[model samples]
Target chain A: MKKNLMAVLVGVLLTLLSLSLIEVYYRAFVPPKAEVFAFVPSTPVEVPEARLSAELISQIQGDPIMKWRSLGSAYEGEYNAKVVDVSKQGPLGCCVLQGFFAPPGKVHSRAYTKHRDLLYDVHFTFDQRSRRITPEVSHARNALLAFGDSYTLGEGVNDEESFPYVLGTYRASTQVYNLGLMGGSANQTLYEVTKLPEKRLPDLPDQEVTAIYTFMVDHLERLICRSLCLTAQGMWRLNQPFYSLKNGRPYFEGAFSDRKVLNSFYTWFHQSAIVQGTGMVLPPQFTQEHFDFFATMMVEIRDVLKTKYPKLKFYVVMYPGSSDPYGSDLTAACKKRGLNVLNYASVDITGLAQKRERIAGEGHPSPIAHMILARLLNRDLPQ
Target chain B: MLLQEFWDFMRERKKYWMMPIIISLLALGFLILFSQTAVLPFVYTLF
Candidate 1:
């Protein structure tokens, strides 16, 4: 009986080992189909090379996102033209390109790039020397501060195609500073805003920044939680107490280690899953905290901006997601704070829904969503 | 006498049960890593 049992155990172990080997083999040897939702090139189409010129090269470099390409090779293609070294935007360095294919006469389909098989569509357009905000967007106004993650930063989309750029196009007079960094959480947004110089306020015309719009959605919860863990670990790494809260809540106060961990984890997770899929899941109850942090951050931003330009308008543009419930949470939060919240969920973004397959998989909004959002903001802005 | 023999038999066989658990955990870890880094990237390229 003892001998029989030993034989069975050995057999089971061999079987498991065999299975692991098979899995690795399959993954390494077999090239699976390209993920439909991620950015994989379709059939290579052709376009005229002459369409790209020194003038166009100069124009592309002017946008903050596209400017990094100035240091590397820019090649034209028959279908999708490629621009290398767009910048170190994410996990792997990003590449920018423009594809000339569009739905029958809709002009060129704006070209963009993706890293780790993620697709970002670039649709923003700029004139020669990309530095000058298009004449249409150079209006005099209180500063426009846009804050959010990849979506707000226009990941998978072109610099011109990002909603912020689109929105800027509508309001030609205002200086729209694109502070939307990818993988940013609400806390990071607050941290960044806190660091801005106070002396820059007096230069504005209205003596008040018109609006500070911070884009937010459910993903903020997971990012915040990861940020907290990273903060704790960093303190431990530095031989310091991570931190203890007054109310017995785990909060990181002031320690540089705490901040470093938060920043690192924020970057790590942002690249891992938060930016890859529909974002990390949060329990239903924690949804309120998500909205609250966003609100609190907005208030803090308002106070800081007000100190410099005492009469600035603060707006929170609730970002849309596949699972977002039509901005109900944002409306409630804004109502409580007496703030103006843009109801982008009400806008007709049906075109984006139709092209959803070309965009991010199952539920991510596509470039059409950005366009629809831009149109909504354009309509809402004081004409 | 038969009951006494059975108890001794059970005691001898006890170590074998742990073998399956260890094998299963190793399998699970390998599977997770393979799925995340290898399988997913290959699949991403196809679509």
Candidate 2:
């Protein structure tokens, strides 16, 4: 017994001594060499062929070449979205607070892409309260609400070149509302659906509304990811909302909601690179439970919208990555709900970039791709 | 000498089973402290 006790203490001592050596070495070397990181030049992020085409399209359409905008009555003003001040906000504060904000003003500029003769003037506008991109023409009924992330919001393009604008202009009377939020998720979109018009959602039973949801791969991960927000500037934070499944139903959970103590611990844990790299203390993969929660949420969203618009035409446009397994899961879930889905998995828009890979050749369906979708959607609309 | 005596004390007192866990925790703490500054970015590449 005495010998055994001695062995354990010695073992602990040896372990501590070894760890001390490592700590000393790291303390001496790692901090000084922090900036000189080894680069592998490979990105784990893989956009599906269709998604890449979409990105290329988005990029090309944003090209400041040969496009012009007539600043009209629809122009409200230029709104700076970067003023959300990340330095002052907490996790939950960051989540809902950045939802929608429209300041007055219009930005009309004649800009051109790098070394391209594509000169275009873009006039950007937004509703003061809802931040909804006010259309050049607003219609009361037959409202088409385009909801999604940056793709629907036209992240890199002008307001005139956005998909919602193109689709709305497909017919003189089509009233399309651009409700795309940058860095937004299905969770955010669901929140938008819950609070339409002037907060608390529109409850007109007689109003015919068509809500189109654009599906992206990261939307699911973002839905349940608490504190997993990776900003455009590439900063990771222990903030953002998450949705968890309970009793076969998935509900949105605000950041650090119901887990103040756990949040405290994980927030500290995230600051450690070794722990994060181990992947043990981080978010688990998309499990069976997550898939179920995802499917459940879609039903719940539709159920919520159904309360107001019983005659709601809710459609989902699935633009999934080629190798993404979640696309199939989404299709299966949408099918189970008997929802109408337009799949662009087979549409290879990358090849379309081969000709003017410089012009309208690449990224999130270019303006031309938006035009194509507009025409396709027009064919589906009852003429 | 200290390590040897400590081992002898542990043997006498019969506390040999808790060795692995203690060492692992110690290693993790040190590793985390050291690796924090460098690997902050590129977290998206992992998850």
Candidate 3:
């Protein structure tokens, strides 16, 4: 018994020693490259808590139930162009409701390179529901639900510049809800659409409703919280929904924060030498299974909407040439499952390569692009 | 160090049957340490 105990203790110590050595080697020899810290400016720190206005705190505290729902605490009601980034950009423009994340919501920002050269300056606005503000059209007969990431939200553009706004005004009888969120993936769309009917879904008297989900290739990376996505989104994204597919159905496994052990391990792995030294990704490479799972999730979104609105028209629009590697595969999968897919890969919108089509420095579609998309959508949307 | 002590202990005790278990554990440690892709998902299933 004594010999066995000694052997077990030796074994345990050796295992621990091996792990420690590996950790030390990574920490000491494989330091992250300097370029790895490249020039991505984080959101500026909010005013100190001691100096925070009571109203701002109460409003920006975020939703208790949704947990990951609200924007940061620094955002205030009414625009102050100098408020966004006092040093370079002017404050935000007027009117930010109690929604959306800080920095990204209802602010005018000036982008600059490492040497502080001006890039692009623009404003954003959100409604009380945190949804991006799509200007209301008088006597709207139908409803338009626009979903996706920053592109759908009109990240680099103003209130009247989003495709949803143009789409809304085009029909003049459509109530548009811009449900796009920056950094959103299908997970956000699934979550929002799933909970929308349960919450205060907008009442529309129209006989038909059209929902457009703009698919960019990177959106898939965001769904799985790929290393690049996690790195880009930073700390603010921890509590956001993380989903996995189970038995051909997308399952909400809760936010990353909810899984403590995995979160800690993942956090460590992200910062570890194995990734930094080898420049290797931590998440498994996305595969056909993931695309199939995404298609099922889209189908689930369609089912939820169809159950709620009998005359729902759901469309997944893949931007021309943007959804590479798996775009056609996903489109085929969605069509096989009876979802309408519009692939813009072969459709050319003029001035796409020009600075006019993209936000300088930021790369989000400019208002021109949104208008073009709106026009194309208007032409294609079933009457 | 500890590995030497472990090997010495195992040999001294003639508990060579434990060798495979020790090797397996060291191999797992390396996998966790160097694995660029997700290993946590598999590890999570164990819990």
Winning model by DockQ: 2
lDDT by residue (tens digit), candidate 2, A1-383: 67766766776777767656755665555532221112112122222343444554555455343243222221122221221112343111223423543343443333233344333333456554444363555555567777776567654356767768877766676567777765556667666665454552433457677877777655665565433333221222223345567676656566424457765565665544433344322343455556556666667677777776787887777642221445556666676777766655444333432222111211233444444455445545442
DockQ, computed on Cα atoms, for candidate 1: 0.07
* Overall local distance difference test of candidate 2: 0.50
Task: Give the number of the best model, judged by TM-score.
Answer: 3
Binned by DockQ into CAPRI classes (incorrect, acceptable, medium, high), candidate 3 is incorrect
Better of 1 and 3 by TM-score: 3
Alpha-carbon local distance difference test for all models: 0.42, 0.50, 0.58
Decreasing TM-score order of the candidates: 3, 2, 1
Model 2's CAPRI class is: incorrect
User: For residues A1-383, what per-residue lDDT tens digits would candidate 1 score against the true structure?
Assistant: 77768866775877667656755665556443221222211221111123334453333333343332221211111122223232223121111111011111111122233332223323433222221122243446545666555456554455565677767776766666555543344544444445434311224645435654645443343234333223221111221222223342333353334466456755564333312232221121345655665555566667766776666777766553321342566556655777777644433233223333124321223445555556555555553
- Relative to the unseen true structure, what is the C-alpha lDDT of residue A91 in candidate 1, on a scale of 0 to 100? 24
DockQ of 2: 0.11
Off by over 4 Å in 1: A1-143, A198-208, A226-287, A321-323, A346-353, A357-365, B1-47
Off by over 4 Å in 2: A1-95, A104-123, A128-141, A195-197, A200-205, A226-242, A256-259, A275-281, A320-325, A354-383, B1-47
Q: After superposition, how far is residue A138 of candidate 2 from its true place, in Å?
A: 6.8
Candidates in order, TM-scores: namely: 0.48, 0.61, 0.64
